[model samples]
Target: MSSEIRQLEPKQLWNKFADLNAVPRPSKKEERVIKFMKDFGVGLGLETIEDEVGNVIIKKPATLGMEDRKTIVMQSHLDMVHQKNNDTVFDFDTQGIDMYVDGDWVRANGTTLGADNGLGVATIMAILECTDIVHPAIEALFTIDEETGMTGAMGLKGGLLNGEILLNLDTEEDDEIGVGCAGGIDVTAIRSYDQEETPESKIGYKIVVKGLQGGHSGMQIHEGLGNANKIMNRLLFDGFENFGLRISEIDGGSLRNAVPRESNAIVAIDAIQEEAFILEINDLANDIKTEYKTMEPDMVIEVSETETPDQIMDLGVQEGLTRAIYAALNGVYRMSADIPNLVETSNNIARVIVKDGHVKIGCLTRSSVETSKWDLANMLRATFELTGCEVEFGGDYPGWKPNMDSDILKVMVPLYKNLNNGETPHVAACHAGLECGILGTNYPEMDMISFGPNIKGAHSPDERAQISSAQKYWTYVLEILKNIPKK
Candidate 1:
């Protein structure tokens, strides 16, 4: 363990998080982490099972006389979003995360800290390793590919878990308890284009927009953060309409669940119009900076000369793609009428790629209301279809409806108040997707609630987890387990 994390209180939890940091476990590529987890469980002499879909379940019988208590399942995903600064040279597949203590929080050096779920996983590991804490029969369920897709949760068979209560350790806020979460689906649009030779009289330039604080698309959609793909398209569309620019290639964003932080494009323009086009781009960049100055203080736009390309996108295809992307919905569409400050429906234009003879655009839509979810999907489909592109939707997951009368909530609420001297914890639903929803489909009878230590800037390089909250959260979990109602 690193000296920095070794000094934090709750050494058990931080030590486990440090160990996880030394292993590369990006979403959809968790083979190493899976083996590490299995080894950790077996080393503790616990019964461990790895399902066909890569989900790991470690069962620890109740301590002493607590066997009659209802079985409680503690759940967290085993993967982290792989993101880094454009200049950072780390590879998620080969390099472990570099973690450090920043004042009251733990963060990475120019990369994601993976604390969104790492802290939760560490907490579970700590509980399993400690024999001194009193608890009911316990099952630690770790799912895979949660950031990119809920494949493990979706493929988990019914009756795989014998638990009657599920405690999801994936929520971000320390003081809030998540009882429900939005369902989500991904939309992809693809269009084929012909290549046209670049005119000899045209000059090539690379235009870039970067430094935006990209975060979890669903969690930070309402924060007014600039979307790099949208911002880049706006500039491209303006250049296409006013300066007669032709695009050779464009790429932005990497993951569908993360807001795009940076985008760059190679475009050509008639040499005669180059000076005026540069001026116009500068003007637009300044206006955008002024508009988002508060939210994106470090946002940068750069236009630099580049070597000419052999071919460019067909004029018609370039125009159509620019128009479609500019018109696509990319932010919160509605807010919940019942839950104050909860997003009801939203969409994120997550990524764009211009490849060989084609361009693909990806989006993610989330909503707590099932009908509203599909309504947004149709809206995106119609928007893209109007631009003569083929659109498809899949990877849909159901929402976990909130149960105010839930047995776990009934026990946790009062217990939390007593633990904190009558400070009532906030109960709410998250806009982001949680594995609890998919797990609920397989085990409809399980009562579920989610809570975690404070984490900020999830899915981004700036991600960090609060130090003090981890200790309090660990204590809370232990107390909750001790108070579980007997069967």
Candidate 2:
């Protein structure tokens, strides 16, 4: 563990976070971390149970004289989105996150720090181990595979938990309590293509776009960051029209929930036109850089020579694929009429891939309104269908509706203001998906609210957690627990 993290305030929470940094818990591959969590609970002599889908539930009895209080469930996901810089060599399946403190924040080396829910999990661990804190009966729920899909939350059976109140420790901002979140569904389009041999007179060049600050698709969608997949399509469309470029392969982005940061493509052009094509690409790159100068100053665009491939995508397939992607909606489409500055509906053109016989495009759409969610899905389906591509939707999860009169919110909001010296925490709804939605379906009577320490750039390699905010959040949650209403 790094000495910087070791020296952070609230030794218990930071220490547990350090321990998590030594475990690899990427989404859908959490066996090692699961064992670690189960053992940690057992070592503490708490009642621990692992559900069929791998959600861990650890129960601790209430403090003396507090046994009559309503049970509170503290929930956070056990998995993290494993994203890394292209130059980084770490493997998510075998390697632990290499984290270190960066001034006032803790970050990883060229990879995601997993602080999104790790900090929450660690805080729960700290609370379970501490004998000094006063709290009612606690049930710590560690869910799995939240990054890719809400598999754990979806599979969670009703009546599995007895808690009447659930505190979801997954929201990023320390100063905001998330009362609700947008539901989401993934859209995928695929089109089979026939390959044609590259013309003998053509030379191959690789075009790449990098250095964009790709972030959480939902949380950062309104930030105006560039999406690499969208940018790549623009460049490809231009090259196709001007230079007669024939694409051999194209790939970009990785996760459906993260904004794409980098993209690249290999294309063939007549050797005589190569010089002009290169110059045009450079000019286009500069134009893009200028357009996004404020949000992505470090954005890089490069076109370089590469080995010629034997075959390229058929002209018709190439044209259709490029056009479809270029026309796809890729950012905020609508903002809430009721909530100021809140995005009510949005789309992320998350990923694109070209393989042996087909090209596939992946997209994710989110909306707080059920009607808008399906509206956006149908729009995406129509866009792809026009290009003769087959489209499908999956991983749909319902949104959590806000309850201003929520029982837990009534207690926590006032408690937060008191703890923060009269500064009230912002109670808002998120555009991103949270497990609270699915959990609520199983436990309709359970009152829930989501909040956490300040974490930035979630679902991307730039993710980090604020050190001071972690300490402050820990103190706030403890006070809330101490004041839980008696049943």
Model 1 per-residue lDDT tens digits across residues 8-109: 999999988988888999998999999999999999999999999999999999999898999999999999999999999899999888888888999998
lDDT of 1 at 458: 97
TM-score of 1: 0.99
Model 2 Cα lDDT, one tens digit per residue, 352-380: 99868788999999999989999989999
**C-alpha-based local distance difference test score of model 2:** 0.92
Candidate 1: pairs in clash: none
State the C-alpha lDDT per candidate.
Answer: 0.92, 0.92
What is the TM-score of each predicted model, taking all chains together? 0.99, 0.99
